[model samples]
Target chain A: MARTQGSHSDITGPRIREAALALFARHGYAAVSMRQIAAEVGVQAGALYNYTPDKQSLLFRLMYEHMQDLIAAYADQDQTEDAAEALRQFVGFHIRFHLQRPDEVFIAYMELRNLSSDNFAQIEALRRTYENALEAILRKGQAAGAFDIADTKIATLAVIAMLNGVMTWYRAGGRLSLDEVEQAYWDMVHRSVTA
Target chain B: MARTQGSHSDITGPRIREAALALFARHGYAAVSMRQIAAEVGVQAGALYNYTPDKQSLLFRLMYEHMQDLIAAYADQDQTEDAAEALRQFVGFHIRFHLQRPDEVFIAYMELRNLSSDNFAQIEALRRTYENALEAILRKGQAAGAFDIADTKIATLAVIAMLNGVMTWYRAGGRLSLDEVEQAYWDMVHRSVTA
Candidate 1:
């Protein structure tokens, strides 16, 4: 098939990326072959090379783009003066982001080890940036005397772990609405770090 | 390549299990071939069949045995009547169990999807039994007015998720001792649910 081009015409690129994310999430990164992704995307295996040089590039792009999207979303939020409100926004954003794009979240977390060492380092750096954003929020909260965390590092890890764990169980049609789930998690989180 | 009974007898079974666990945890169940597992165990690929019928059986056994061990350990705890004490024991047991056997813990959680539907169902049922044990404790605490949870199911999931999250980051020679980590987690758990 000829490469299609238009204002929003990177259709094959997105299709390949989406197919890769789903397969990586389901069967893991190392287990999924380029041919499998091509089959899922309804393209010839060789045709995939036009989009990605290799499978590693495909995995790297999926993760890199996902991280960029995550950071972009968080960057859009206002930096509130109120520590509690800022923390709430952080928690709510995290829960909703992971719940909405579970395939990306799963690939980002589960497929890191499959990347080559250099690629792994790049992804790791992006992940740390995301973590640091949360840690910065916790530090601000601590500075304002709104939180009472003993160790900011451990506290940040614990909170992120708890938030990320939601992806394992949250269902699209679950009994709890996203609002209610976010509130419940925020309740635990607030109590976790506040005096 | 004769399978000497004594050469295989002392450690082959456990070795095969350990190698399989690590490979499955690192590469994922579908990604790991029996040949890779045998190489890790220093045996012929066919020799692995002596211990496990197939890859799926190996995966199922690792998870099933881990759950069984978890249930057994918790069963042996002191039958204290105080719900707070029971909760503490549960948290402590989980931290110790997960920290010490992270390979099994990682495989059990990450590789479940690779199991056949029938195998997955069996493993999930075993997991539900463990969850119910925790939920039962929370329900009892709620009944006694010691705990203030609006939703028992959600509360149970939150606590387990936090505990399970430890395996992702916990390192053997980490600064925090197992006891210290357990205490910190219990502090969060107590604050989140207790009145």
Candidate 2:
């Protein structure tokens, strides 16, 4: 049986993306080239064009997909109605989601400067949507008298950044178990918001 | 007026580091070249070698100095004996110091991957020293029954990471003034570590 064009692209597209993400994460986006990505994907340079138009598009897509995946994952995991429980779940979810995708997280923060203005705006909007999800949770908690936050927007950013720090130093089989790490962060985050 | 070798180096060394820091922050370490940095500083490419042996040295010096400056600044400002007051001063110092040097802070986090192992080790040690200072404060607070931290090291990192997040969005004429931003973080940090 011959391989269909759909199957051929389905296989190549992900390969191209994986190779691109790794390269851009290892070397900054400005240092990576189309030829290098094609080589990493085991394809001709011209073949990459069949999937994405250029390097900028490739960077945008990686960041865009990362944000989308995060939003989707958060949506899937969150089922709580109580404000405190919701915040706890968000802490665990954010830490585990980000820790597993070190490369994506690295590229997501590091390569934002490389995106074109239009692409930057688009990525920024997607990021804001995700941030809004967290802010809404904080707002709910505030109205319910569970959280004593001065500024929900600042609180959202602080919580995310605090969790994002785990990716920098956390390793498998580290001193603290993942569950323990998550619990410690939840403790801090929970206290920071509540009275 | 005759310029001595000392004066010549004093002027060129700083200029070279400034140009390299901007270029590295803008395009990344792997993407920037000595030729480009020299061009940015209005010097010949070969002239850059006289101040710094190579690109790696240039990158390392920029990071090393940034860390040193941070340590020195922290040492100079922290004069309080009360653990709670000391922690508050740290929160304000970290935010103000980092906010003034956006490019340096960006490169310090972004270009770690590009450093040679030796250079990386030195930078990591310097970083740990800074972290230890914060950890020391937390320890004092814990011993004094002022802070209810599960893990002081983790708490130190979480607080620093949260304060660092301000660099990504805070601006001179933003909705919040600098004092307000510092106060907000100090509030969250103080609450998170204390009962």
TM-score of chain A of each: 0.92, 0.92
lDDT, candidate 1, B1-195, per-residue tens: 334344555688998888888888877777788888888877789878888788788888899899889888888888678887888889988888878888888878777778889988988998888899889999999999989887788888888887887887878679988777777888888877864
List residue ranges in candidate 1 displaced over 4 A. A1-9, B1-10
For candidate 1, write residues A1-195 as lDDT tens digits. Answer: 333433333788888888888998887887788888878877779878888888889999999889989999999988898888988999999998878898899889877877889999988898889999999989998998998877777778888888887888889778988888898889888888886
Which has the greatest lDDT?
A: 2
**Model 2 pairs in collision:** none
Worst 10 residues of 2 chain A by lDDT: A1-10
Q: Among these predicted structures, which one has the highest DockQ? A: 2
lDDT per residue, candidate 2, B1-195, as tens digits?
222333366688888898999999888888788889888887778878889878899999999999999999999884788999999989989999999999999999989988999999999999999999999999999999999999998998999888899998999998999999999999999999988
- Considering the two chains of model 2, state its CAPRI-style docking category: medium
* Count of backbone clashes, every candidate in sequence: 0, 0
Q: What overall lDDT goes with each candidate model? A: 0.84, 0.90
